[model samples]
Target: MGVADQINWVDAACWNGTAFDGGWNTRLATNQDVLEPATGQALWRVGVASAADMTAAIERAHAAQVAWAATPPRERAAVMLKAAALFEQHFDELALMIARETGGIIPKGHHEVRESVVLCQLAAAMPMQSQGQVLPSTPGRLSIARRVPHGVVGVISPFNFPLILSLRSVAPALALGNAVVLKPDVRTPASGGFILARVFQEAGLPAGVLQVLPGNAEAGEALVTDPRVPMIAFTGSPGVGRRIGELAGRHLKKVSLELGGANNLIILEDADLDAAASAAAFGAWFHQGQVCMASNRVLVHASVVEGLKARLVGKATHLPVGDGASGQVALGPMIDAKQLARFDALVQETVQQGATLEAGGTFEGLCYKPTVLSGVKPGMRSFDDEPFGPLVNLVTFDTDEEAVSLANNSQGGLSSAVISRDVGRAMAIGEQLNAGMVHINDQTVNDDCTNPFGGPGLGGNGSSVGGPADIDEYTRWKWITVKASVPQFPF
Candidate 1:
């Protein structure tokens, strides 16, 4: 049965003063389903919470966080470890739910679930590494730098890769002793927020340390603007990220915004064409290219442009496209109809601008066939904006200088990749790119659970939210000094 024909709509889950209570329910779209994009199919059935309820939840979280933070880091680590184990135990179940809710292919869903487990494990080990430093100071005096939690953190998560991204933000916040009142994307709340809440509860988290409030932007806005919420960690579009920054700015709250990207992938003449082609295919198509770090633009050397395009097209064509639940499916439907429309509009715009459609430009229902376009220029929407779908734009450059120029043309500096047989040269180019993270001879989506992952500039606000360094994002540095003798007071 089609998604439109399946399920009843109801409040999937909500905060009830102390804990998340309710079950998942399907509801009709609040707007005309036809006018709404495929990605927006999941309607907002959960009753919207009043600002007072949100304020109360934040207050409760603050109260719980005082005691929760007082609990030793080791104890918090234990709970995180248990949650990781629980994540592993429920991997298949979580993967299935993720696939259904977000339209992630089965394999990709499984990969994200496994990665989520690893992220929790990494978060669990964070306390051991979150040590303070002693600074050299004047004789008979000591200076110490310590990390402190920000009391209550409001996490506003996006819909794409819902479970993984939400956990990526939440696990670190909880591990660092901050209470979290998460506002998950309205579309895929059950798969991530609801599931993780169960995991945390089972892992013995304090009653109010982790709360899930699933609703629309109003819900998230309420959380971020609330004075009790000291920090806001958000992952979504640059437009939304800007709004979040503005709100957080007005309140003088700490903010971490992981926004959109029109990432570039450069293929040098000396690069192993096969390796570059494979990486490009995976980077472009993974999770239907919904990832913030996905390579949206491809800049290949003119010397090997034909070869790279041939191999990439062949690989993209063989990818299995079907329902996310079928298990054999490699590419699933766009997250919802809204996303499909956006993808369609972008591709149409590209065609109108005179780009060549190399393969897979048509859509069947909500399924956008993996597409590749050649002869793309920097000024086109596909090159300047994020498509957030399984579409790849290929442009050719004659030299490394030209490639760097082309790659840096986009306003986004989230991530980039340089493929070349000359590792040193690729590394040099990678460093020169303005992206937050760059890969040599590989794709930008390759991330380590224990390594810092975030973009620079518009891609991110120079904050690292993953890896061992992630604890720093959840913490604030406080310096303390002790003197051997108190100085005489002067009136």
Candidate 2:
């Protein structure tokens, strides 16, 4: 049987008041097929659920969350741990599906799945780690603050890194005792919804505690606007994020949004050219440069500009571009046809604005070659816009002040990387950059599970969704105090 016959497109897992009961509609349409450039064969057809069904599921989840939140944090952590183990056991399958559905290379897809599992494990350990402080107040009176979960959290995830991002929100929410109603992006729902549902079920979580409603913007908007859903965690475009924020604000709902970014990479004169070039190539071309944190703009010192440009061009050109399912392929196609058009327009606009195309400016089917542009001015669309493709714009600077100024010129403050042999100089330069996270002598892909990670300014709302500190973002703190001696005042 073909993939379409074997897989269910509209697979719904909902909490119907008392229990989880929903059927998988395999015949559902993705509206199009993801075709391989070489063979022109269909890889998958992702489907979406209706908005009405998703709204009902969110209501059901909210009803069940009241009881689930009453459970102790330690018990909830245990369930997360079990789910983590199940995810690890089926990592290969999950990875394969993610690659097929999202057009990410196999190795990258596997890495995302591994990170998702690690996120679950970290979330499992969050209950004990989510500690509050004791206030230094009056003597003989004890005052403490405790963190509590938001009732029912609605998680809206993106297409890129479907499994990891979805699990990132769901695991933390679950660990904090918040029942989750997840809405995976319509483009790659199966990769996240299918694996997560299977893992949660295998871990023996109660049906209503976790539910997946895979659908498009209508379903996502419905889930977010519902009053019962008190918190929303969204990862997507800035325009959509702004709308979500406005809606949540009107309804008095708490929201954490990780939006789009045009990240910059700064390479100083004292930097190691070989290492910087390799890091730049990875940051610009890895996963087809679809990541929100990907270094779309590069500022290199004029002294080493020629050498760095040569190295980057060579490295980017050699990367194998093909279908993600092919294990040898280093770069994959853009997420969809619309994204390809957008990327093409950005490149063309930059060229028209007088930027010189250095390596590539061609497209075959949905595959856009790793493209590099030089002589790009600061205000061009390519320099200012978010190119969600394998494209990098390079600019040269003479002094550290100029480099910092150019880097901070944009509105995005998601992430930045500085490559230098001198650790002290790198650290000093890193301090001057206005990004939320910085990497010295390395790329910006080093996201450890033990450290807080999030974008800044227009890129993010200063909310960390991973690491030991992430639990704080998912919960609210309340203070309690008791009188030392029942006030000796007579009535």
Candidate 3:
């Protein structure tokens, strides 16, 4: 079946919860084709939102915020729960569309959809969670502080993991009584923005409560600087995230950023070589290494570096790679040629700096082979820069201390992992690493609805989302006090 048959709303203009602007559906000058990365086929043509479009969406969201926030908490939770149900009902369809839209394998498509469902369900529960607490004050006064929603939240999500990342902010914000204006990546507008808006709309969300605007940097800057949008949630590269942080600071707006990472995975000498190899392979090649949490640098113990490398290379060479829409494959195509070129340049520079290419280093269409590099150490391009492709760098460390030092040597510390047969020892090493999230016996790429998802330094602004952190990210405390009568005061 064609993609249009699978997703009926692919041709609609952007979902702004307002009257369609003249630019939409007019095939105007700003319209761009959404291409299937693997085949370079145009799946749909969408109207790119301009700065004016962004302002309109945010204004609508801001106008709707008061009524949505006043809607009973149970009513809000009900709508979110229904949205979660709709996501579950359309899981397979959404997964197929994700694969076609983003060049992700079937498994990754399903994973993204499932995580988005989990996020919806998690957000549904927030309405019932304790929003605030009563505090002691004078005998005649009752003082309390309660969490209240920011009027409107502007969400800027990336192309990778589009559905879940966008929903992570949208779900919680709406459930907490805040309206949302989401600006998904221009590349995957349907899966990231339109599909989400469709789901929530079907679930009985009121108009203007959630708006999806697909646009470029101008729209993003408008969303950030809009005085009405009190908070901005962004997930993307470090450069753009830093720029957003700076702009938000100048406007005195609250911002939460989830940026890029050059994460590390360490294999101790005592680690089960087979298991460690499998973990490393999955971490580096899963989703074609197009994830912030992908294991970019592998720090293995000197005694077992060769052993682990052999197993990892064996896995890399055998894993299937192809167009995701064709069938199940271990690695899918890169998002596009630009991203592929970026990753390829990093690999070439690293090789020129003396690292040995062990397994694969070529491409077929957008599918780059799962590549493994050895003799990689600090200061090498492959070791320092994040390759958001199917590539892994192998480095050797003599001791656990050295392993920790090497792992901590990067400015980006989003996630880290350590593999060892000794659980306590691995845990100790994981603790020493500078990453926000650490795994003792697993790989660097990991996620869950209940865990806090963020890191310190370049990974983020030391702020977090998911689980309990969502409350802090989406709401602010408002102190309220009441008394039966005014106390007599001597002035």
Best candidate, lDDT-wise? Answer: 3
TM-score-sorted candidate list, best first: 3, 2, 1
Superposing all C-alpha atoms, what RMSD in Å does each candidate have to the true structure?
4.1, 3.6, 2.2
Model 3 stretches with alpha carbons more than 4 Å out? 8-29
Residue-wise C-alpha lDDT for candidate 1, range 1-491, written one tens digit per residue: 53333323212233222226222222212321111123434432343445555676687788799998889889999999998998888777677667777777777778878998898888888776736799988888899999988889898888887777889988988888899988777667666577788788888998888877666776677898988888999989888988999999999999998886768899888888888888888888887888898888989999899999999889778887767667776787887767789888999899899999888988777778889999999788898889899988999999889988888887756789888778999988888898888887788787776777778777977777787567678988999999988978996
| CA lDDT for candidate 2 | 0.77
* Comparison by lDDT, 2 against 3, better one: 3
Indicate whether candidate 1 or candidate 3 has the larger TM-score. 3
Q: What are the Cα lDDT values of the candidates?
A: 0.78, 0.77, 0.86
TM-score of 3: 0.96
After superposing candidate 2 on the true structure, give the runs of residues whose Cα lies further than 4 Å from its correct spot: 1-47, 130-142, 482-491
Q: What lDDT score is found at residue 24 in candidate 3?
A: 28
**Candidate 3 per-residue lDDT over residues 250-283, each given as its tens digit:** 9999999899667999998888999889999999
Error of 2 at 154 (Å): 1.0
Could you tell me every candidate's TM-score relative to the true structure?
Answer: 0.90, 0.90, 0.96
Compute the lDDT of residue 489 as modeled in candidate 3: 96
Using TM-score as the measure, name the better of candidate 2 and candidate 3. 3
